[model samples]
Target: MDYMVIPDFVERKGSLYLRSDHMNYSRATLNSNWHQAREAEPKNYDINVFPKPPGRNLHTATYERIGHLKSKGLPNTTTKSALEQISLKPDFTERETRKSMVDVASFGHAIIDRELDAPSRGFGAVLPRHHPDYDKLHLETTHKADFTPPYPYDPAPERPPDFPDNSKAHRRYQSQFTDTADYRRSGRNTWQDESGVYGNTEDKRTVFPRTNPIPERLVQGLK
Candidate 1:
């Protein structure tokens, strides 16, 4: 499902409120896309809403506003109450808000600040639809999937070598880890030699290359 928004808010007089523009914009985009998708391909397009993991009833209010905008009916949106059963850590309200309402910009900015602002890589996992962890994993994946990032974002990378897949179950399990290695831990100051060479020390605990370093075999005409 594509085209989604997680609204921003400002706390005033003990009540949290989103900007008029924010609500209007979100409603417009959502409604337009909602109708377009239904007309274009009613069967395939499914609108999935993901509210900021709640503070007070702000999450509910945000979704309610969008829901009200639709003349037909509200499409598929993940409810805050349903999310309570699942663990979506990093309290959205506290972590996602800006200093002032004016500072709270576009939905794109909010998503980037939520995922990329941190020192370490954010939450991720690849799991099959049948697995117990699949729902949560899919939730995280879908949240990020809706956004058309300025930079390229690949969810499933190529399967790595040395993956034990001799057995059928092992091969099935291999699918769950296609993107596992992509989310590498940042190796800035953790493992540096006196010469300041990263991953050059004997500890070997932080020897992670930023990208796949394996050299491809020379072919007849390939560079």
Candidate 2:
């Protein structure tokens, strides 16, 4: 059969990701999610038959490394050693090798691009100790291809939804706390209160003396 090889395109939705096949085979399998693909059998393809994508083709040095791995009894399985052998090669860039690993469900705990004196937690593939570039290797986190950056700084709004009920205790506290001589004095000279508890006039809300809702014990504590 004239086999087809799947391209390394990934799509992530929520915790699940659909990836291209990475079995080193020409039997193209697309949209294989990690959670489901790892349980299947490993594949073997003619190294020459598979079209070496622009950045993923193995050069002479990398092919030698793979040959070395084979000589050392490291089979073309999804084992940690096999993945590491691939990662330590010079043919594929770190990013390209990592994507390939993910396609084959071989993204162990993490990918070690640099020297690793000790094994790191949650990392499956590690840098080879005898590698010429071992000194320059370092640990790197493996994240989803479409990982999102964290949210920016955001302070809570002044007018919160804490006081919703209009109960006797609420009314009593509101009357005693709102619009008093001290409140008016604080409002007029808000600059004096550097803590910004009373807040500015822009939002027109007293952000000071934060509203702590403990309605269950409100009456008991007030008495």
Candidate 3:
């Protein structure tokens, strides 16, 4: 868990949609995970996410599209923003499109981190693992025989001063957030005058739309 994307209570439909990319863990797995965080918070545990490597399905395509959009001066374009603009909340989708589609326009796991453990300075204790691939805590120290993450992970991270036992149980996973409008509600009025920000129709299209505008060539020079 890197960061939970709860919308501001007063945010608008589009703004309150201050949307978040779905947590990537499987539904059943995610259930177990949240439970673990609830139980483990007092003992000094934390759940974190990391950037997944590139060149997969929709994740890659979204990542690529993000890069392209960034180059054209699209300041806040991100996967979460693009999806919410189209009313496509990853959590709400019947089936996750990330696994099936070729996405390269958004940040999958690289740019953001979610706070999994609630309360207690965003840390937890005795975290639960949803999927076999996900780590229970940050990998700042070596795993003991009881730890259960897949081996061959990055063996070293500068351990945080307050972290006890070096966080061997938690390993970071991929991120699904972006700077798109739906994901963040703070600056919409400033950058969302879709008619054009720079007074250029083409450039204004760079803004994420409220629908799937990527294939429509809505923003031609983005990224």
- Number of the top-ranking candidate, with TM-score as the measure: 2
Runs of candidate 3 with Cα error greater than 4 angstroms are: 1-72, 76-84, 94-124, 128-223
Query: Ranking by TM-score, best first?
Result: 2, 1, 3
What are the models' TM-scores?
A: 0.11, 0.11, 0.10
The CA lDDT of each predicted structure is 0.42, 0.46, 0.43
- Tens digit per residue, CA lDDT, model 3, 1-223: 6998984445454332222344544223433245544453332212233335352233322222233354554345587677667664555667643473434665474454556455423245345445654666666555565586775777688978885442322432222233234544454363543332232333333442356637646466563
Candidate 2, residue 140: how far the Cα is off, in Å: 11
Clashes per candidate, residues 3 or more apart or on different chains: 0, 8, 48
Between prediction 2 and prediction 3, the one with superior TM-score is 2
Q: How much does candidate 3 score in TM-score? A: 0.10
**lDDT digits (tens) for residues 1-223 of candidate 1:** 8878776444456443334432323333443244444453322222333343332333333322243355655555568567675566555436554566345355445543344343342244232235455456444566577876888777887778975443332222212234334334345543322343233233332333245455455443476
Off by over 4 Å in 1: 1-146, 154-156, 161-223
